[model samples]
Target: MKNASRLFLALIGLSLVVPVFADKDPNINAIKARQGEMQIRAHNLGPLIAMAKGKMPYEPKLAGQLAGNLKLLLDLDTSRDWPPGSDNKSYPHKTRALPNIWTSYPEIGKYGKDYATSVNELNAVAGDGLEALQSKIGAVGNTCKGCHDEYQEEHQH
Candidate 1:
């Protein structure tokens, strides 16, 4: 927790010190921005899943920290970064976001709301106990898969 706080503070300080420049290409920048956010989400989620699956022992402090970090992400205003024409069809190998994300309109909004709901539910119980965390995790996973199924481009392994 102390490490996370220090990192967060350092990032905030760095942002203030660093010179801000407009992106030469907003489309590529937008794609990178949103993908970075998703990567952050996945980074926090991996450990929770590992503990839930018994691949790692459930540590309440770490569980809470991870879940808390996810909850913090909910405050980000990333909608403006997801401009149309920034998907896989346009960026090719640069992104897996399908064009449908923009065309689907409110359909994608529903998925976002579902994801927020699931994340909130999970955060509420994550530090309570292993059983509590497990109970709400499937809903969160389902929300992610639901969105990916509808909008993300599939890659063959």
Candidate 2:
């Protein structure tokens, strides 16, 4: 009976371990590449935000271009297969994403939704001119900060 019990436990352990070593998903790699691209686009939003904050001179034409770019980036589907290294490996560019992001994926998705909403609103106002958009900048600015505060490292600028 003891031998039978030991055999049963060993099988159960293998059942759990087998999947971890299963073939890696190609979709995950594609998703990781897309995510890397979005990170670069996200970084570019800073200069536009700085202009709105009056840290730099505001150019309505440039603001419109930046706003359009932001809209495109925010509209991307960022959720794809969880990148492999995201679970355990930390890269130089990666911020230590909270583990809860994996457990609570829906909540993490809300941050993207919020960003999209803000970008849409910003784009509407920015289309007219910088002055028209300046007042609404705070709402959009907070959306960027809201996600980065949790998911990204602090930028010097």
Could you say which candidate leads in lDDT? 1
> Relative to the true structure, how large is the alpha-carbon lDDT of every model?
0.89, 0.69
1-157 per-residue lDDT for model 1 (tens digits): 9999999999998787653445567787788889899999999999999989999999988998998898899999998779988989888998999988888776899899999999999999899999999998888888989999999989869
The Cα error of candidate 2 at residue 54, in Å, is 2.6
Worst 10 residues of 2 by lDDT: 87-96
Worst 10 residues of 1 by lDDT: 16-25
Quantify how close model 1 is to the true structure by its C-alpha RMSD in Å: 9.6
Which residue pairs collide in model 1, if any? none
lDDT assessment of candidate 1: 0.89
RMSD of each: 9.6, 12.2
Best by TM-score: 1
